[model samples]
Target chain A: MTDTRMATDAAATWHARLDSPDMDWEDFGRWLDADPSHRAAYDAIAVLDAEIGERAAAIAALLPANDDEVAVPASDAGVPDAGSASRGTRWRWAAIGTSGALAAGLALLLVAPSNDGAAQVYATGRSETRSVTLDDGSRMQIDRGSRVSVTGGGTPVIEIAQGAASFAVRHDPSRVLMVRAGGYEVRDVGTRFDVVSARGRVAITVAQGMVSVVPSGGAIGDATMLNAGQSLTITPDKQIAIRGRIDPARVADWTDGRLDYDGAPLTLVAADISRYADSPLVVDPSAADLRFSGVLTIGDGSRLVDQLRAVLPIRARRVAGVVHLDAAGPR
Target chain B: MLAANRHQLVRFFTGRTGSVAEAEDVVQEIWLHVGQPPKADGVTGEPGAGPIANPLAYLHRVGMNIVLDRVRANGRRQRRDAGYVDATTSTVGAEAIDDAPSAFDAVADKERMARLTTALTGPPEGAMRVFRRHRIDGASHAEIAAEFGISRSAVEKHIAVALRHLRKALDD
Candidate 1:
């Protein structure tokens, strides 16, 4: 259908659907099965819905101003606070499992470290990511599926539990920037780069300056001196090692509302999107050999699968909130 | 909506536009865009569609887009205008404006916003239920209450009460 015609039809259907008192599984199923173009239409409208949600009030002056243009989007995850860690998940978009447990809204502060401070929690939610400005005028991208409650916002002692995250440790002579993911603690003198934690391992890449990551005190995770264009892999038992440079932009794509990679392993890409996505993106174990390098929008992860299908015989289906991606029948 | 009836609508486009006439023109543009549908998705309105359950809301949104588009379309002119804004203001009342396209780019960071919305949404459980019932589920107050096992009045109270909290949290 023409874009205009499609938009009209989709909007009408959506309006009717959204207005209905009861929108059940059968209804949604019927709508989906009714046409191949159904989801395409829905996604188009979803963009508009996103537009409405963001600029509702600003547009309200044309409406009643006091009208319901103030309607908000859904919380990004199962729990409102959970989605707070990342972008929120609406009911319609809740077709994913294991959304990132995000906290709500931004908290900008010039955090100064207290000498006796304990770990304070800073978190982002599913489909949500955050960058906090430190007192040293430095910043860090808090990745999805993780929470690091540092003692002081200045010291920036965050623990990475699962998923990939990055930090641009502010350069400060007095402060040692440290991040703990599993057993490995990334200690830095001053540096900028990316960090990903998964399968009981954390990979740290230094993009600028240098860092010395030993364990918390004299305890060491195989201490390494990482400068620009270098990386380190820290295992669960605090085993640390070194490597070469990675594409910081591609790894840090989530910070910019994008999921991008260069010849990225499908399994690894799935793990990446799986962090910010409300839905879990599972790749076929058989197709683990496949490599994907492209951009996927932060919201509506099915769009990523759609992009993936353009090149490979992969299909994604949602069942009980799980989005399973497997090789399509035949090739 | 008629021009005479659009006291609120005009104000909506005012911030987007520099003048009352431009705002009115945007209102006219809204009429064309709204009565039919959007180019992208057409006319996906909600049940109550709330305050925006009319043509005017669509108009305002269109107006805003128009203004942004105008800004983009006039980038070169605006840069020149910025240089002469002081002179123009002293002469013909130009707006004291800093042309910033990057501010829009700043909106792209999901992390900072993610941290923000968590607080605005008030820990999810509190407001999400109401938001879903009211917007996504299209459920009535009675239906929502039945689902939640609260009275209809309780559901209404929930929405009413939730709005107060959201307003406070969002600080709007």
Candidate 2:
């Protein structure tokens, strides 16, 4: 073989080896020190790998055991095989495992500031506003009755399990910011986006810059890069596709004292308000299809009840932070 | 109209009878009755009937009964109305709904807009833009709100002043 061909073969071999969970650290370090471009390439590959694992965990949330077949299609060469763990257990894979753990750890990332040193949880009762400062200097607001677990694992990772949660991510490309729930996984290299999980689907709306949601895993095969005004939805089965533009203001309105809905389902509004309310907004048989527009002020119960009574003709009253809505007067 | 307005009826019925699907079923019944409206029963009255009071209110009450009867036939007061208003609208509007929609879009709510306008009195006109950029647009107000923890009054004040100024500017 020609000298150039010999060198090319060797480089490809090395590149493949580094991606394996068991690649030699000494050899990898020597390579990284050998060339700056080599280090950059490695960093890119590592970030990409971490993202893939994260996507899997996100997809895992929505997929039933039956869906495991079609979700990680047998034809997909890019997706990790469901049987990957059987190959070998390597500590180097710890980084990958940590990324996976972060993805898994993410479901528990909600609650006060203590789940993880870097995690910040913002919770609100019905009609109450909750704000939090993340370790990365970003801020998050958890709308009434909702709990979000935040962690700064591979990047500043966070997961919203239920209700409504808003993220104001600090710009840090070096640290990826992610939010996971149901079938939705939002990864921002460093952008602002709001992720809401309700019903069985997760909706990701980009407010600024760009963000990417690939069917819970990072691959060009299933990824859709979203820009400002763009949005994506992850179906109940881990399927994701570029949806359309959503109102950026409404996406992050919980913190701003406005719960903006353009004919949203009462179930969704209930989910959003459930976070702030001490008592959940029960979308009853009478209230489920009700679509409310304009801002539903959330701060205290009596006021919320009064507001519901005044604006929409629904009766609502707060017990603790839980504001119950009913057709009957201020129950 | 049943499909198109099924959702609107859900919202309207949601306001009145507090049943989204009952409102929806009423819409279904209304569609059956008025779908071909011989221009008699559907008109409610004549054109000169003049801005009828509580037309929607009366319809909402009618729809509620229909839904209740349907539910009562099966016999249940569901803790959760999982079947009301099919998610067709939610799924369709999911991507299109604006959270921080452009201020320039035609907002249909005049009273709320007036309230937003009235709230702008305390801050300078630029304050609303800042409010839009930081709060509405989701910018961290650390630099704009001028503190790590922004106080409620400061935010209200910024908006109030901006609205007041806008109201004045528009008046001229």
Candidate 3:
């Protein structure tokens, strides 16, 4: 066979193996690296494969139906219509909703607090991170799938309803900033910190300065002071609060699309990944105590579980659109 | 594993793309696809489920696919630019000069669609059906094979044949 023909066949074989779990990626890489023409051949095949998918609906409309095969009922859920114009319209609406939410987020930052002291709620969509600068110049970077309500004008009371956020409060002894999550309050005169409130648990990581953590109605004298590089976590059932050391630089790294964990619980990692995940991610009880210490790049939020699987001895299985992370069995 | 071998992946991509910056961009894209959802429905096996025999080689393969995607995009952009220049020079006094690019794109898309339609008809018997079932209908290879009363490899061959024909048609 001609070199071009041989490369084309090899490229086709590699493309076919793309969906295989046991795919030999290293061998495939070597094949591509062996000759530059091999790369060109593989590129054409791969791009064509993707184009076929992109134009699937259009192509389906053009082609004759598979009359001999059993036709899948249209009412079946999760199965997209092979030739539906509605799919296009749904995508258009999705695009509009994304931009609309972004515009609303910007407007929320500019709007002045109401005189009535009514709390204004701010929320971020799945896979979206938002930064808000309050009137007092204290900035809060809200993580994906999070909600925070702001009340009070000069001395704002920020409440995290769900998910995580990082704060850089302007140091002002005269005006104290209060952050509430899961019935616990963080009082700051001036500091940078991260608060994650989910699953009835609250974790506060202090990157810079000092912050006092106390119950909502607790007195200041009884509050626990968390200094820079210290993290505090309050368990849901026991209400037992534990303090630990953390890298000051890694606090709120999610704002930069990186999840830097230092021996964090698997449950906590799953909770963070759930923010960007399309389906609910449940951690198996057996894997509850597993701790993860690594840096994961959150690009579009799809591969977080994959990255976790690579480092941790965990396997993810999707059932009814929900992903479950379980400890791997002995091979 | 990806975190530990990130530097090596960058080096591999840099060697191929010839620029550290571009290599980093490709590596970033690889991270996105590393834990991607399984392509076939009801397929429980994860890509990196077990210990990879050669992790660096696996990463390099992922990087290669991303580089190919970038190359393909560049090729498409160049083709579009050449078409735009051709249309502008050939039709100096044409109406709606401002809409030339969009018009040209529409024409190109229409031509490609027609070619694909013609190519679909030219594939060998049953190849088109298998391709449509898997690609257009999103059926797994196992599902398509069962429907056709054929082996999984046969289903794959049909797909490869259909793809080869389609690629040739588009090239023309």
| Model 1 / residue A321 / CA error / Å | 6.8
Per-candidate clash tally: 42, 55, 0
Q: Please give, for residues A254-298, the per-residue lDDT of candidate 2 as tens digits.
A: 667766777766665666555454455665666665776767866
Residue ranges of candidate 1 with Cα displaced over 4 Å: A1-115, A144-146, A152-154, A162-164, A198-201, A212-221, A232-244, A278-282, A300-302, A317-324, A329-331, B1-172
Q: By descending lDDT, how would the candidates be arranged?
A: 3, 1, 2
Off by over 4 Å in 2: A1-135, A198-201, A215-220, A231-244, A262-267, A277-290, A301-306, A313-331, B1-172
In model 2 chain B, which range of ten residues has the least summed lDDT? B85-94
lDDT of 1 by residue, A99-190 (tens): 11100000011112321223335666655677776544567777655665444334455666566667676543334566766556666544
Tell me the lDDT of model 2 at A288.
Answer: 62
The TM-scores, one per candidate, come to: 0.38, 0.36, 0.41
RMSD after Cα superposition, model 2: 29.0
Q: What is the DockQ of candidate 1?
A: 0.02
TM-score of chain B of each: 0.35, 0.26, 0.60
Task: Output the TM-score of candidate 2.
Answer: 0.36
Task: Please give, for residues B1-172, the per-residue lDDT of candidate 3 as tens digits.
Answer: 5667778777666655656899888876554434322224222222322233344444555566557546655765576567642333222122222222456557877888778767766645466667767766767776776776776656666676666666767776
**Candidate 3: RMSD to truth:** 23.3
Q: In terms of DockQ, which candidate is strongest?
A: 3
State the C-alpha lDDT per candidate.
0.47, 0.45, 0.66
Name the 10 consecutive residues with the lowest summed lDDT in model 2 chain A.
Answer: A106-115
Query: Candidate 3 lDDT, tens digit per residue, A1-331?
Result: 5787667766766665443333444455456567788767777877777666656668778876644554322122121211111122211122332432322221112112221133556898877889998755699999888899776544577889898889998743333467889889887756899999976679899898767677877743346667778888897579799888889998888989899998999987897787677788999887887999999988778999999999999999999988999889853
